[model samples]
Target: MNPAKVALVTALAGGLSIGAALLGERWIDPEGGGIPLAGLGQGEPVQWPEIRLPDLAGHEHSSDTWSGHPLILNFWAAWCPPCLEELPRLERFAQRHADAGIRVVAIAVDRPEATRAFLAAHPVDLTILLAELETITLTRRLGNRVEGLPFTVAFDARGRHVFSHLGALEQDQFEQLAARLDAPSATPR
Candidate 1:
């Protein structure tokens, strides 16, 4: 083989190998944000990790506060439009389900002032928890691969994670969640 041809072939092979490696990396980590995927499963019993954050009123809270009861854990941000759009419906859901021992909790991943402002104007009747970057970590722990806004996680009366949604919860989804949590034997959805 000619010397120039041999060098060209080797360069091409190396380039292709590098390209394949880059493609594989993207497939494994789509967002390139370096969050390891938990691959959380539906119906799989999961323990909620202990997280401490302040509320709009500047009261500190731990995740365990919502334990021992059915909970709707929503991870949202003030900048997310979908998150904002779903707040009213979630508030209504919380109000309707509050008597049934279901606690709706919203964990906001934004500055306290922004969250307070948004809540002050919108007025959601649910527990709000403020977090910084840990909000994304919490969402990932709950099986949100994309860490998208409006992520919701549901826990049964026993405090086992039963359902998780990564996008805005539709009305039907909220109703179905209510039914599942209200049932004695809540199955994974």
Candidate 2:
């Protein structure tokens, strides 16, 4: 085979590979934004699953521990960089909204030991919960289609899920979510 022919074939293969990847991304995230794959549950009455996960101290707590308040449930892992990046912002939001009855809970989809170590070095004001192997299923039920890190879901005081984001919640996004927190809770069906 000629050298020029081989180069052309290799280049074509590389271009095709890149094109496929971009198309797949577009399909998964049609908006080309941080939003997760849509249609799971938004502006709907999603009953929070009944699972008792543990805190850093190993005390089991129900998912409804913060019921009757606006809640932000963030699914994360210590090994995930984006998850770590959003912690400070979430902590600040939690502290700022403490008096408003808004709760920010971070459910760590990692080992208890890993979560404890990470929290010790980088303390946060947000309530941290430990999840085990059921993390993926739990997050999926809560609108995490890609099962990715830093997934956030917001529930109104009535425990209705109002908003969900797949990626790190940036400042602007958080502002939008904060507004949703103030929205009147859905009337019970």
Candidate 3:
């Protein structure tokens, strides 16, 4: 075989191999970094879907309006045991961090009657929202599916999802996530 021909064949083979590798990386799991949030390390920004709801007192509210501030969204029904306990803690957390640009949005997924009665007795201090049919639409739209109550989705200032927890959360879990929220830009997300 001619030297020039062998060289050309080798270069072409290398280029084709490179192309195949790149294609595989793009279509398959790229670099194996897309694992769940099991680790405390920062994660990809969760772009939550637009959601709307009413307050306990019956007022139209849109999730988009809460952009620019970090949002703590808690999915709960008035009757959920863990939620009852979490409301007070969430309220306190909201009050403690209000000046820090954190906005706690509690979304109650239950009948308006039940929610009203629950709120009258419990009186949550955080901004509580009612999940109407509109809420159902929005909830389904979110990147995270709503399997049940007590689902918490935390969003950054840009409405990106920082983390989500299914089931009741103790104060420390949120505290760690808050620390991540306050991290400097140089830190890896």
Candidate 4:
């Protein structure tokens, strides 16, 4: 083939490969990380999905059951180091804020055995619910289409989303969140 023809073919192939990767990423992560607070209105009330799943002990519960209390819902997996590191902090935060009507709920997107084993080695007081592999869709519903581990979403007493974050959270961040949760609730719209 002529040198010019070879260069043209290579450029076209490279462009096609880049396009495919971008499309795939978008398909998998609709929310992506570009907009952390996208789709959620500021101070606007939005109803969260009714997430029903079983606790480590097998008791069933739903997200609505935690209504009237500020909730910090965290999606984690046993295999993720960051998720494991943040579990204890979340547990302590939940205990400290129990009197303030704040609850921390952890949803594990891992096999039951794996989650149980991890908990056994590193115990926590916060309720750990099993979402297993279904957590991919469940996290997306909670505005975490990036599917990153240790993602957290905070809801006000009215069950409206107040904050969301991806990646590991530091102690100070948790403290800040606790303060926000303890604040007076705004009138639901």
Candidate 5:
């Protein structure tokens, strides 16, 4: 790839990593068992719970669409500066990985009007899901009661939890994520 392409990918991964990490993690409700992702040394497969939310265009998004692929589910809000800074990188990540069977899904945690206004000014190509009333329920169910926006959760091809970063992502970090796209291929079918 050209320098620009390389730089772009690096930025996407790094931006997401940084922004999300700076936001840090929300302590999961002890009552709510957190879904284990990485740094746990947990050998179990990742599980992506079913989520149904509206898209920016008012269309419903079935989280199952991301099934059978490495899903990079990102959470953000328009009021969030880090998220706004990382939009383009995330969009580019989605485009390049479209053919790689990896999906980048952005869930807007803001209200409809705010989300609409943000989308209007900064159009993006990724499927922007709305974390509406239903999403709130799902977030709680997913052990995100403390609710940290600008979070990036990666799931394996089988919908198993892989890894997650809680801040802005840079290009290198993103490539590491993209590397996951090739991970399943290493396993026996």
Candidate 6:
């Protein structure tokens, strides 16, 4: 084969590969992370799914444990930088709002050992749940299309999803959500 012909073929192959990858990212995995169809049901009012995840102590707990309270579910992982950065803020918020009947739960989307080690090093007041394999699916159902870490979903006392955010939440944002939950119109009966 001629040298020029070989170069042309190689260039075409490279271009085709790049195009395929871009298409895959755009269509199959919109989150850009490898999980297919991430965030598929985002922005919908999905009732809290029935969850049975374990804590650091290996004891299983049901989602109903926090029922009848304004709940905040934060999906995080030990390897995610934003998740680690926002934990302290979340802990402070949880501590301050404990008396308000608002519950903050941090669901670790990582290995049990990894979550335990991370929590041991950086203790938090938030209830920590471990759900390694089910994290993606659970988060997607709760309106996290990107399947990204530090995803948060807020639920009313009746277990209705009221709000969701995909990135690190600031203290002020947490305060605003808490205020909304405390409003006369928003309060549960």
Top model number, lDDT = 6
Query: Candidate 1, residues 37-141: lDDT per residue as tens digits?
Result: 234546645876677888887888887887778877888877777788888889889988888888888889777888889888878778888876777777777
How do the residues 43-124 of candidate 5 rate in per-residue lDDT, one tens digit apiece?
5544787888888668887877766677888888887777888878899888988998788889988878888998998888
Tens digit per residue, CA lDDT, model 3, 134-184: 664554344223344466777777666666654567776667656766656
Descending-TM-score candidate ranking: 2, 6, 4, 1, 5, 3
**How much is 91 displaced in model 2, in angstroms?**
0.4
Candidate 5 versus truth, CA RMSD in Å, comes to 10.8
C-alpha local distance difference test of each model: 0.72, 0.73, 0.65, 0.72, 0.68, 0.75
Across residues 20-138, which tens digit of lDDT does each residue of candidate 4 receive? 45543433325442323424424546555578899999999888788777888888887777888888888888888898888789998777998999999988888889985566776
What are the clashing pairs of model 4?
A: none
Off by over 4 Å in 1: 1-44, 186-189
Instruction: Write down the worst ten-residue block by lDDT for model 6.
Output: 31-40
In model 1, how large is the Cα lDDT of residue 4?
A: 75
Q: Write the per-residue lDDT of candidate 2 for residues 112-176, one digit (tens) a residue.
A: 88889999999987788888788778877876655667778877777776677766777666766
* Local error of candidate 3 at residue 23 (angstroms): 29
Please report, as a residue range, the 10-residue window in candidate 1 with the lowest summed lDDT: 27-36
What's the residue-level lDDT of 125 in candidate 4?
85
How does model 6 score by TM-score?
Answer: 0.75
Residue pairs clashing, model 2: none
Measured on C-alpha atoms, candidate 2 has an lDDT of 0.73
